[model samples]
Target chain A: MDKTTGIRKRAWLLMFVVVALVTATCGNGADDTTTTAAAAATTTTAAAAATTTTAAAAATTAAESMTVAKVAVLVPEEPTDFGWNQQGVEGAVAAADAAGIESEVAGGLGYDAPTATLRQLAETSDLMFAHASGFATAAKEVAVETGVPVVVWGSPDDREPGLAAFVSTSAQEGGYLAGILAARTTQTGQLGIVISADDFNWTRHSGGFIEGACSIDPTIDIELVQIGEGGYADVEGGARVTAILIAGGADVILGNGDGSSFGMIRAVETEDPPAGADKVWFIDVIGDKTSIDTENILLSSILWDFQPTYLQAIRDVEAGTFGDVNYDLNLATNGIALLRTENISDELWAEIQTARDGIVDGSISVPAADTRAAAEQLLGCGA
Target chain B: MFDETLITAVLVGAIAASVPLMLAGIGELISERAGVLNIGLEGMMLMGAYGGFWVAIETESIWLGFIGGAAAGALASLVMVFLCVRWGLDQIVVGIGVLLGAEGLTSLLDAATFADTRPRIGITARLDIPGLSDIPVAGRVVFGEPYMVYVTLLAVAVAGWVLWKTPWGLAIRATGERPEAVDAAGVNVVVVRSLAVLSAGVFGGLGGAYLSLVSAGNFIPMMTGGRGFMAIVLAMLARGRPLLLAAGALLFGFATAGTTALQLVGVEVRPEIVNSLPFAVVLAALVLLGRNEFLPSALALPYVRGER
Candidate 1:
């Protein structure tokens, strides 16, 4: 409008250009990428001139999304955990194979805060699956910084649309099934739920169990206890708590602790039966550890398969719906199911199948509970 | 609900939870008294757990496993001995490095060997006292425990006597309180401190072995679960008293057991409150009962012979 105003505006525009150039050059590990990306963008814009506006937009979108060549999976523990870590590594490999892409497993990274490893993996990976809930924050950080898509666990809200996605499991439905089985098979009618942590997944599953057990028989002695805040590897705590529960009229135990489940199994193996109970039985969760159960105490496990979940995540990336859509592995999709162990008899499995059918058909409604009180209420207990 | 079986269960569980903390605390207290604050107790315990579990499974003898566990702990502590005592490195830093190294090493070794099979060892056989084991509810819980339990209890008495009544104990106390003075007196402060740390490693290892063989019947990675840190805290609170440290450990154990009991009995408490109950009690004790007077004067300070 005015001569001085025009001069000021021109100066500001020059400053902005300078700042952009400085940023493109100064950003750590992003300088070369920035230059290459800018050249590609110029080429794309030129190509778009001859195409329809909608087709141009679609092409631009396609160009922006990475052609995922290799996916890397990071876990807090070794894959030999026989539970979460093992399942996660196996799932990542399976998904990579299905998508005809390469997969790298970086497991046993520990539970401390992460970012260094995520950055290292991002150097070679198009997609990274951070297999622990604790790794979500670090994964999101790396995703935003590197423009590499990442899949994290437990936190759907942390999804950054195109950058990060999350996977949730139908743990409650599987938990409900476990409860019904426990109630049906229990000779003493005293079932105990042992959790290593006060995790949302544990609560969801434990609550489902309480609901199912109560449905079978109201006023059933359902003892619930947690080892610690997150004692995922507190094997002694698992054994100690389970032994106490067994002593306190609990013949059937629903145990949910990753590495700690072995302790529960140990207690079942060694401890004598309580006065009213004939034998001790352990129902587990996540990946099946039945192969390692030398004693036939492992009754069942509400399996949480991440293979389908990871594969779906890969497909969503290809479809350009990456973080825009959330994924849930549920009984409805056969993602979560009860592992039929030899300890579970034919008659029991038949009844379980009937329940499974009911759940699938919507005849049985398994309520979602992410809290202890809510789980208690679901079990018909006045919390 | 408060029947004999339930009472017995709670008490027995409490004992099981307390033993490792107690043994580790006592060991830490001895080290703290000698001026070397070993922060790698968690790592040492882990190594012991692995070593103990492996030996016990291989030998089918739980007693030998305890020995293996203790030896492993002592071996792990040699790093602390070399770095802190011999080379005059920062005690806290060395301790942390030891912990990280031990955790990584044990986990790597464990995964390499037994991660697939997940083998479990038989429980250590329990021993029952003649008349004392016949009491109503606390009978088996108090007197009829595994041989290691009695040994641990005896260890407390022996450690107390050694700490206050013996020349070596006096030397350890003097080294912690006044390393310069002890060195001047030709007591060999480094030797005393090294031995104290080694003792701590043995006890920490034994505690870890007890966890794998007697408590859980198997070893799991990072299964020590910061109990070694808790032991260090208990040591600080106990103020050079082995029996008091054991009491503090038991108090922590009881609080943890109470949380479980309350949950099992369907007590209507907030999940956050229930989860934090044990830690809350420990903190409350630390605030209320943990007097800071008797801490070793030169706890983590590396003694530099003639330096002021």
Candidate 2:
């Protein structure tokens, strides 16, 4: 081969090596890109973009003078998951619609460092919500880089004075209610908590569930199995762990995750009921799957409504009070509530309502366990 | 806490989980035994999964779904054959490109089609070996499984025999170890390498299909979850031996299910430690058993007719 040809081949090989290394280190999933149609179809103009930048820079409290024009959300997976991603995207959309603003959604970004996507989204957005906990550090970095106000999850300490904020949820309240429902309905006196990861939302929800189940029957057998440290998209692991929990005599299962929860639902729909139970019931969190529950095994879900939180964030950004305090979504604000399906009996539903009122009225206290060890202690299975 | 029923369930799950790894590993073993390093196996598997899921949804036939999956994988491999094998392009670059393309296409297709409804397939039927399935815990654990499991085991045996006991097998081995010698011996190195890559695609496709059709009973974006990479590692650890590849895959499967088993029985260890158990086992196995194993000398190098 000629000298030029040989040099070209070596250069090409080096380029390939770099691409392979990046892809490997970034981990597997769909590539991170934007849906331009989704972002561009909205009625956003240069005036709105200018107002957002001025408000972010001035940090002024003139809420009436500054108008929030456009907001965007970044999710690690597709919003169609009917779980965390979907809820976050829907919340952004709803908040934008409520404030008469445009909304942009950048989904399927995977778990890679979304510096590029975030920078692209910030060019047109007045505010951004980094939906996944995995995206927190990247979101903070990009917020400082692009001068766009960003919201993240479970990192209150990382919030900047004006650039970044965080959203926290009292999901355990909803979990406690679901636990009461499960404890009342379970035939085998066993409950299963299948966590796709040791996420903050999942850990707190599990702790509340164990406490609530025990409130009804202190001797209830509650088994918690984590699929993996980061099995959020591990559908097979979700199914396998759920099946094992079922075999261990858990009739009512509380499942947490994004796409992996679908696998848990599949396991419930397919696996035969344990020895004493005639049917298996699944309680989900963050999003409702009643529409897609083909086999009707879905009993309820600890629904999370981020619309109010997102809307308030937009308002705070306009008022120059962004990042002053973390946004909290709880049962009292109707941000966190339990779904009541037809599968639940009227009498049981009434009892659940009373419990809900008690929780809202300060007559009940739900334990908040934000870690696996804390959750296990609540379950009386601490190491 | 460790009852017969729980033990039986764990064993069954381990076998079910191992099937995909074994299928993909054995296929990769064949490809590596030839002169090609199939880095795009993950991409091929993802394409197969998408094809299998789309076909299964449209046709409502599991058999056709599997066929569609295999065809899709082969179709993806044809890209590698044309680029790396025929044109003698850089295999690593082409493989990574194929993987990225597959991920984007599958995710986009899934979002457009099933993101709204999220339709799920019904329960897959398990085949019970008539007499053996009735023999208590061992019977159910060993004899009852999806039919694909048996087919995969048979494939492992066939792969082993073909790689060791056939004239064509020697050609494949020789091509990997010394492509120039194979070309001089009138074996048509290009054709042999192409066939090996195509086989890898077919096997990888079936593995992906088994995952969507039997294991998860539905397709999620990126649902293969790095199993393709795991298969590649197993294939490397096996050193071109199909039987050893199968064993390594099974070990991974058991280790995965065993983590859950340990947690289910209330083992007082940290989850981090329990989760790392599988990797520790694999590393230990590699250190002890794979110490002397070596990859083919000519693997991953594009063969040129007149070049050294």
Candidate 3:
């Protein structure tokens, strides 16, 4: 019996050694990974801290450095596209130039590409602006990896530590403006707003436009068409849908899709005018007719100035106080503006100007409609 | 809303869309005909797009971008050749590896290259054949195109003629059909197959270059957007005949253009559903084509000397 017990004990001891060997191997492997992660985190923190210090020192020693601050702007589309992406590019370039910073612009890069670009800029540039919400993931990853403060425009994610801050314009307000334009311009009493499906940003714009138009003229018939569920690269679908709306007698059209907007513009341009009647008008989003060079067709545009917000976030980054929260740029802050042009009659222009002044003076407080309740309150609608 | 102009638009759009697919399909056909199946065409095309765009942006020359794209594709294919030929790795797994690797590399490189520099090329100006351009719908469809469209057509014609008429083509067919016989005939089958795969890489690269340098005039990650796979499907549909490949490519292009046109005309159909029609058609075609036994007998078999 003792011999059998001894053998069992030996077997147990052997099993323990085997288990210990396996445990040691796994623990060592995990330790290696954790160490590398920790090292990366430390390096990133150091780099970020260094950047902050350098910025502060540069401010103090402005005369000594004599080197202009450099800002890098990354966009998801060509800067000259005359749209939302273009506006960001233009604003960033103008802002950087005005601030005496050397500005560089990159376009046609997706989320992953911008991250690497941001990292490279973080090493040298005073500020880096990732100019699209699509770049949020890449920007966040790179910012954390490189410990660089990245300022993203149109991004909703405010949780990352290295993310300097987001500069968001009221897309809802822009939508409301589009609605007002459509409502005022439509003679057929039928207007249509074509949105590129259910993006939160597009939804806000579409919802706000619908609300604002309904508020102005409750009897005006409004048709809301959502084109394609997948994200906004479908220009053909946009064109097709716009044609349908035109067939249905929508005299004025508003579109919030990026490249898809070009299709809508094309549809209207090619549409045959009703005999002896005025041609249909379009309200452009993010840019005006000046960018696209089409004035007769486009009535006006809703524009955003991202410079003030971008600069503010850069300042925070330099101060080493980058926070996680949405920085609201509303009509009151001169962040949003409606383009003024001769095409708009003096009477209509005066009315829009009055509304603008009211918004600025807080008399007509356009309730910030980020939520469903806010949207309802702003539009004074029961939904 | 559906008129002669719409029909013309569909025709033009189809021809335009066929350029990328034709280039990639012809390349893939050459590779497959040489007994090497490369599923890395997608990744290679993406790398080529970015490389071409970057080169064009830097040099302000579209031709330079095209060359850069070709080089990038060649480099990418070299990786595949090394794995499959040198290491004797499984071609499918190696292809998947190559696809993933190329994607990651292109994404990283694209960011590094384009960061803070938005470089764009002007759209290819339409070339109008004075007499032909006056023919209304047909004129717009046939005469109104950039030089690249003509090149794509010329490429298909030349590839078809070469594959059927040349001694090199015979050797390639021999290599793909019965490698043992070709090896006994004193031809280095491996070398011929590698060259075919490399040529395919070049064509795939050019296709990608065309996308960024001519078609879109800019680069985006994954911008090849499965055109490479679509090209492979086209090749399968055409059964490796270049002329038939061109027709199949045009069909796909039409489907794509039709879907887009229909959406533009406000057909109230869900965009998602409409967008998927082209892929569905391709799948259906594959099912129908699968019954035909036209594939090269030795296709996908690694040529090992002295193995029974």
Q: For model 2, how does the per-residue alpha-carbon lDDT over B1-308 read when each residue is reduced to its tens digit?
A: 88876776677667767888898888788999997899999988888888887888888988888888888888888999999999999999999988898888888888888888887776666676788965655676667666778889999999999999998889999999999999999999999999999988988888888778777767888888888877887888788889998888887777777778888766644546744554566677767766534778888999989987
Cα displacement (angstroms), candidate 1, residue A112, comes to 5.4
RMSD of 2: 7.6
Instruction: State the lDDT at B276 in candidate 3.
Output: 64
Candidate order by lDDT, decreasing, is 2, 1, 3
Residue A51 C-alpha lDDT in model 3: 57
Q: Report how far off residue B105 is in candidate 3 (Å).
A: 3.3
Error of 3 at A146 (Å): 21
The DockQ of each candidate is 0.47, 0.44, 0.06
For candidate 1, the TM-score is: 0.85
- lDDT (tens digit, per residue) of candidate 3 on B172-221: 77877788888899888888788778877888888888777665556655
Q: What lDDT does the true structure give each of the candidates?
A: 0.82, 0.83, 0.67
True contacts kept of each: 0.60, 0.49, 0.02
Off by over 4 Å in 1: A1-60, A63-67, A110-112, A137-147, A155-164, A321-324, A381-383, B86-89, B128-135, B178-188, B266-293, B301-308
After superposition, the stretches of candidate 2 with alpha carbons farther than 4 Å from their true spots are A1-65, A138-147, A158-163, A319-321, A381-383, B128-135, B180-186, B266-293, B305-308
Which residue ranges in model 3 land beyond 4 Å of their true spot?
A1-169, A175-197, A203-229, A232-329, A338-383, B85-87, B268-294
